[model samples]
Target: MTKVLLAGESWMTHSIHVKGFDSFTTSAYHEGGTEMIAAMRAAGLDVTYQPAHIAADHFPLSAEALAAYDVVILSDIGANTLLMPDRTFARSEPTPNRLRLIADFVKGGGGLLMVGGYLTFQGIEGKAAYAGTPVDDVLPVALMTRDDRSERPEGVVPAIVNGAHPVMAGLTEWPTFLGYNRSMLREDATLLAEVDGDPFIAVRTVGSGRSAIFASDCGPHWGPPAFLAWPGYGPLWANLCNWLAG
Candidate 1:
């Protein structure tokens, strides 16, 4: 069975609330990959999840380590997390560049996919900072330099560019997505889907491997309940994995 590694989509958040001279602060841990994992599992694939916190310490440090999985997905996690691992940042010890390992993994025929979020692509305030990274070079599209987010609380529907594509085989017209990162497709990549002229779903063949990009969240907020509930959601991701893993 094809195995997949999913990283990110889990976070610890701290918030402050103040009203009429009353102030309070609280912290919470949240995960958004439940639906994505479910969708992949439903698609008949084996998945291993690495939350943001764990990814910092456990994300593969070398291509050989990454070889444990057939497909790797990066979602809602910043480059810094992988670049500055605990061993490197906290221990002040030199470490292998995970970003380079990921690049080599894909180039050596392993599957890769990048899902968008505030900490993905050229994220909020450009803090995600993947623009010039090795991973970015292997992506099917080019990320923007500044913040690439497109906020559409009103929802923007995706247009299927090639329903004949394997990933779009069972998918018809897709439901609306709240928002997504605006990315430009590479000349060699195939545009599978789009939203308001921005690249929403794209794919490409990199070296002996395959890669794709879903410039939108797979869960809440951008995905919302309605989008996740869409009948095509599960199959959409399943096919993506199947194709990449091939």
Candidate 2:
């Protein structure tokens, strides 16, 4: 059984009765982290889910407590949630950062997978800016900016780049994704899948550990239902977990 740690915002309350386009009360939508955990567990992997409800003050503590899992999944959360007041750009020179700690964890042999959302990788309006952070160095691809998100109303078609990679083994084409965070890739990165000439899925090796970045959301509202209903979902995520653990 592979032990995995998942962290991200869980408690979200939307404001109600906002005038025109935004007329509704505080409602909670299912998050991606929980969805991934369920998929992993259904594949027989032992998963430990740690959701950061009020993330603004809980991420640093959660990052520091990630030693127990074989892999870590960061979904729908951004940089500001992990930055302590003292570590903000206004106060320090960006030394001894939490992002660095995550990089070090991977370098010291930890697996990591980052999923996309409105708050991931230079997210909408530059929310979860990860370009210059230590997390960027460990990723197989390059993140351009958070505001560069791509919305595919007709959804995207994914094509496998390396069918032989362990993470991709036993899998064919994946289901269409509704949207994704746009990102550039480093020369050393391996492109796994693409959509309209853009890289949709990618992976890279960092020291003894490995990391993968799926630029699309794995949750229901963002990804196709086939991702969870199809037979391939189990093996797809299983392969990812096994590769990351190695």
Candidate 3:
């Protein structure tokens, strides 16, 4: 079985309410990858999740620590989480750059994937900030330095650029997405799919491993309810992970 690590896709929301003379604020936590993880497990793969809040404390800090899994996925999490851990910041203690660990892991024959979201790729306000980082050295596509999200209020559909590829096999049709991160194509990478004529999926072989970029979310607000319920959803994710593992 291929073991996988998924970091991100979890967030906290704060809400405030005021009426008459009383005021109250509330905070809630949410996770977006329920279907994604279910799909992977349905395909018989062992998977683990490290939500955004605890990523810095729980994410593997070295290539050896990361070696426990065959694939590492970064979705909707900023690079700073792994770059500047609590100890490194609050205590001024020297710490390793987990992003660099991921880069090295891929080069050493480990698979890696980066899914898109508000805090992924260049992300909202470009604060996700993976563009010039060590992780960029291993991604199959190039990230924009500025904000990269392309919000499609009306929704857009994805087109298969390489239907015969295993990643696209069993994917007869794709669901419409509400948004995605725009990425530049790499000359050495194989483009698998596109959305609104932008690179949607790209794959490449690293030193002794494989790497992939999926420029859209596996769940909402980019992936609407219909998309999450689409018949091809689970199979598509399973195939992507399996192919990378192989």
For each candidate in the order shown, give its overall lDDT on alpha carbons: 0.91, 0.74, 0.90
The TM-score values for the models, in the order shown, are 0.97, 0.85, 0.97
lDDT (10s digit) by residue, model 1, range 128-210: 99999999999999989999999998989989898899988888767878889988999999999998888999999999999
- Poorest stretch of ten by lDDT in candidate 3: 56-65
Clashes within 3 Å, all models in order: 0, 4, 0
- Encode model 3's per-residue lDDT on 45-136: one tens digit a residue: 89999998788888987777899999999999999888888899899999888988899898899999999998889899999999989888
Candidate 2, superposed: residue stretches over 4 Å from native: 9-11, 18-30, 54-64, 85-96
In model 3, pairs of residues that clash are: none
Give the best candidate by lDDT. 1
Candidate 3 lDDT score at position 141? 90
Per-residue alpha-carbon lDDT of candidate 2 for residues 37-61, written as tens digits (9 for 90 to 100) = 7778988888766565554434434
